[model samples]
Target: MDTQDIARPRLSEEDWLAAAYEMLTESGVEAVKVMPLAKRLGVSRTSFYWHFTDREELLEAMVRRWEERNTGNLVARTEAYAENIAEAMFNLFDCWIDPDLFDARLDLAIRNWARNDSNLQAQLDQADTRREHAMTNMFLRFGYQKQDALIRARTMIYTQIGYISMQVHESKEYRISLMPGWIEVFTGSRPTQRDLDRFLARHG
Candidate 1:
């Protein structure tokens, strides 16, 4: 058999992006270079250009993924159906526990990356504003005054972002135990027994 006839592993754009995303969450954006990713994927460095034009393109794709997965899910969750504001909040809280709805690691990675990148920082600010607005609209939908809605939305978002930035660790059980108080504080109403039951069942 001729060595030239042997086939190298075929890699997809997602394969490259996934490797970059992992490096991003584990190390930092600086660690997400093409050579490192190619090495990690066991592919030729040239193979990267087949998917992305360059490192900058790959980085932008990562940002798009973060925006779509984290910010998109958050906005959708805020608009999820519920009988009242407190129940509505429980829907949003699911983002804290569900990685599908919110990739906290990616969010944190982007924040850290933005510290040294002004353009990315601008994008992050825009995303934060969008998320805050979604929460504010959620509150307004349930009859809160515009001023109160904005305040509560900022409070909820800032508190959650703080938890992510601080890398707070807590057991799911422990966090669930605190849900009622947190919900009441954010929504200005304690969840009814039914609301708590529904929320608990969703997690359970």
Candidate 2:
């Protein structure tokens, strides 16, 4: 190896996790083994031991990172203050449209991983419940009754889940066109032109 290659910055845990996440998306959970990751990083397998105890540990770290980043961001957006339910729901549309904020690819990859593992499925279940509760709280804060809020929250979340699972393809313009109707269905109130304008400004 070149001296310059030997002198490259040492890999960190985040480096490994980032590579693992990429492998998870491009390949699958099964492809996230240590040797492959090390190969992908152009490092020795022994280097992995410096950051993680084993493959399982690295997988756990990946899940934790996903939960903190994706799920946490969703909840934060759901709880962001809005002048009304319409605006609050629009805030959440940010999550759907913004890959940096809520990685739909990673989310779908993890869900596919959970299919055969009961333990991972349990974790996914917990995340789903937490996210639903956050949406419900948003509706409740907007003065929706408890029952109505819960139902609307489920509708919004489940619809998104189906969209991801089905791998539905639509142009941004097409999806944006449907947002006002979606907001009406989920919030029971039509978004004014201002609401549509604000959402378009950010996501259009």
Candidate 3:
């Protein structure tokens, strides 16, 4: 083999998936074909088959990643230990700002893709239910009535979804400035200075 052939590196499953994810995020699902991914990765298209059985499988894997990262982390955050309801609220809110805990871009991409696919839309609905249920239980643990917890949970999650859908952009400093008011609006109590300080430290 020539030196150029020896120098070429093989693409891994994650490499292919990462490329596909970029396409999905940038140009929507229709742009996530194997050929485009191969071109973007500078590898032969067959490399994708080494990891995924087919294009459908790749798409399914993307959805699974979304669920595991976004939904799973949100649920876990709702279950995190806190001294008070305000602290707990900030724990869950961390998902909105932390990319490691939540992928807002992937969430938006999946939601846009789901618009044309009933099956995907159903899955999206189920994920929303799961997140809302977790947050509702969180409020209930903090002494909210069942009905109150449920409505508050819905309002909190729906507002985040609305922000994603509208592609709203705000500076971190500006958003953080409003967290105190938003916490009161969602949880019926304003956070203490200590609670806000703790939350800011985490994000900062």
Give the winner by lDDT.
Answer: 3
Candidates sorted on lDDT, descending: 3, 1, 2
Top-TM-score structure, candidate number: 3
Q: TM-score for model 3?
A: 0.95
Report lDDT per candidate. 0.90, 0.89, 0.91
Candidate 2 residues lying further than 4 Å off, grouped into runs, are 1-7
Clashes of each: 0, 0, 0
TM-score of every candidate relative to the true structure: 0.94, 0.91, 0.95
Model 1 alpha-carbon drift over 4 Å, by segment: 1-8
Candidate 2, number of clashes:
0
Off by over 4 Å in 3: 1-7
Sorted on TM-score, best first, the list reads: 3, 1, 2
Write down the lDDT that model 2 would get. Answer: 0.89
For model 1, how does the per-residue alpha-carbon lDDT over 4-39 read when each residue is reduced to its tens digit? 223565678898989999999999998999888878
> What is the per-residue lDDT of model 3 for residues 99-196, given as tens digits with 9 covering 90 to 100?
88999899999999999999999999999999999999999999999999999999998899998989888887888888899999999889999999
lDDT for position 9 in model 3: 82
